[model samples]
Target: MKRWIILDRDGTIIKDKNYLHDPNGAELTEGAADGLRMLAGMGYSFVVLTNQSGIGRGYFTEDEMNAVHLRVDEMLACSGVRVSGWFHCPHRPDEGCSCRKPELGLVRRAQEELGFSDADVAFVMGDKKSDLEMAEALGAPSVLLMTGYGAEEYAKGARGTLNCGNLRDAAKAIAEFEDGAARASFSRDLREHAEVVSAMRSLEAQAGAAASVIISSLRGGGRLFVCGNGGSAADAQHIAAELSGRYLAEREPLDAAALSCNSSALTAIGNDYGFDKIFSRQLEAHGRAGDALLAISTSGNSANVLEAVRAAKKMGIRTIALTGGDGGALAREAGLCVCVPSSATPRIQEMHILFGHALCGIVEKTLCR
Candidate 1:
């Protein structure tokens, strides 16, 4: 999970020399090296995404531009900081190529080249409006340094971006923001998990009761049918796998199946009947008297899962619904409903898997004995 910062070259990293091809003219902006060193220490790699349109205008050759970059790299290397990638667009403003700033070409090219296509980029920092626009396009925050064209661009009104006096200030601001966000996120996660633990404690008796029913049904030669949609669907498959294979101890495989696992039956039923009938149709095929249907739905109102529960009831199969949000309509229909107290979908899903694992463990113990 590497994080990176996209930087503009001419004005942001060094003095904007304006088509000057002399490597001798390359001069680092005040505090540029120090800022870069700080960011590097914070686990951020750097990518110079610049618009070197002077090549398109025939002001300088690409070879001359490389010389300038080599000089810049040498200066940064003195400070123990390295640019992981350097991407420049050699198109004039009138060229209409996708690689220019405010377009995603250079950024996309750098991401692909550096193996960071799916990585988290902290922000884009530069001294021009085009840089901010590029950051916005990439769904990242922008830092506008009042170094080169930044003051003029700021006067022209580049709103909704962090405005700093220099690269050093920008780096400090970003570091502080990231640190605060990390701490706040940690605190929020801790609170949310604590809430989950409390909810689980309240639901312990109901969970135990559900495990008892599942154990009895399986011992009496009844199969378990599990079904849901989306993340809940994944949870359904996981729970079924735990039961039909083994939870903790190796024993005879239990008769269990996740209704969402069969892709052919799902697509055929969904295409012929509709999405709502996908689970119910599968339940009809596999469900029988004395069997149990473990229906998981975060919203408790997933049409397909609800339909499956109805079908299970009609076929004399016992229904245990793991749901959230006042249990929705599925709670009313199910014989036993374990509803996590929170309406938040993610929290509910976490509790559902915990409950599933606990139930599987209990069933494995009871049946093995």
Candidate 2:
């Protein structure tokens, strides 16, 4: 399923200014552009729903508002992001407009134009009570950021809502959550099929074994290699980065490298040998005995990742595969396969990160202790 996100503006997008409407003076809060760009890169289509009652009160002209939005788009584009749409409710409390906050009309308008019903969005992110209530009404998850009115919202016990320090943190959480849901949902039907479920269970057991191997290797002064393609490639690098350094925690850096981080090597190898050889070649060149290679593939069938794992095994490197669906062909060829029980690519990818983080946490605690 496609993942869409509804983001609030004013307090959420730009810094809240107590009903101020000078678009010329509007500026995005810290990390807002980065947050939006990160979500866009994760395949999320964004729609901005804001209560701009300042417009209804003649504080800012519609033309001025458009100019301000254009500025926001420009900033995002500079960071390689594009907003799908923007919706604002230009009515005051006195006017009692349905499109205003505490009402779902603005979101409804966005749903109509974007062709994604309320059910399609994974989460709504904002710093206000109306934002959470709107998300609840639509049955979508909500992330409350501690920016703008977020502190107040948090103080009011926004317990069920995912809480973050800022928009960037909130966006990251939503992205992770959506990916996990995809992985879980994909494996739902297979749970009823005894054979597949048994195989998956076996795979999970193997993952525990592999985790032990990884811990032992690191304790003995070993490193890790990770690789993939496109989004999976990003995941490969992300996981490696987290383990090598830390994920929201401070600690000594571990020895890890994501072969996918080298763009020059990828292109040169792809041009000379082939895309399938990019990872395997790197593995042959860099992998050593006792090192671990983590291979991530949504379909569990990326030729490059598979080839890389093969090379790692041949080179005496321990291997772990993070895959989705029926474990695909990679399941059979791995030392251990963490097959997230989800067919949905998004969800599987999400779980892969969590698994990576969890693995990192365990490794850090066990070794550094």
Candidate 3:
């Protein structure tokens, strides 16, 4: 699925200037935050690609460049947008580094590190000819902005470039493209999964029951507890975010917690006891009667999660398990087990996200009303 849009930093994220390096001086252009907010809402991952030769020319240190990135990250963070990756070519014009813009080296590095396939990218937004040329090499579309050197680049007539007045417009176009694609993909997947609801009747009933329980607790102003490991950790946080706020729909926030959110507690527990006790220990401290624990496990056999489920049960908390095909011990541990009808890891993960999104919608519409 096309899930990412490459961005050129200077004129696209901030105003472009000759040899700009000060983080304190960095300022987001008009609609920059809103544009990013739009892309984020559509689930489009972002990556910034730029040529920062100032480092190689002794004009700025790598540390300064990182600080600039930090400032940018902070600015985006406030709006709930994250840059999945960032890349810069730190070479003089004559250095002939493969990573310099117009070369696919930096793009290749990002592809490898970020696991982005060129075939799946939708567009590259930039204010320069080099950015367009790079997008061409990767078979991705291009969006040209008329900011900074954009006028000069526009004057040169970049073939196939979608011209925009500023980054905000470009971002809007990109978000629309991504949203359309996501909806299409999601619809197709859901349709295919729908055919199996009859075969997985028991699991569906359990999921419905668990979702009803979640809606009840949330309606009563009780918080939810989520926990998992690795990718499931990300999923745990994701589900909680969707509950604590809106996923795509506008509604009042729900109270939710991911025991894994506190790094200090996790590290302390891991160090003092063991990895298996990290989540259970947190559950002991935070859980209360009637609170719900949403444990996510692809294999449904993660010992740490099983222990946490046990702890939550002991505390009289409602238990829900989001698991994959043939749920292991997690199915037994959970008061309600929603086993996604897939065994393949990727498909299971895909279903998990879809389920979480639907659950968020269900809980919000039911409780907020």
* Tens-digit per-residue lDDT, 190-236, candidate 3: 77666544445555566568789888777676779999998899989
Q: Against the true structure, what is each candidate's TM-score?
A: 0.64, 0.51, 0.49
lDDT of each: 0.89, 0.80, 0.84
User: Best TM-score goes to which candidate?
Assistant: 1
**RMSD of each predicted structure:** 7.1, 14.1, 13.1
Off by over 4 Å in 2: 182-191, 195-369
Q: Which candidate is the best by lDDT?
A: 1
- lDDT of candidate 3 at residue 311, scale 0 to 100: 94
The reply for model 3, stretches above 4 Å from the true place, is 175-369
Q: Give model 1's TM-score versus the native structure.
A: 0.64
Residue lDDT tens for model 1, 160-229: 3688888888889888898899999989977997888786888889988899888878989999999989
lDDT of 1: 0.89
Q: What's the C-alpha lDDT at position 9 in model 2? A: 80
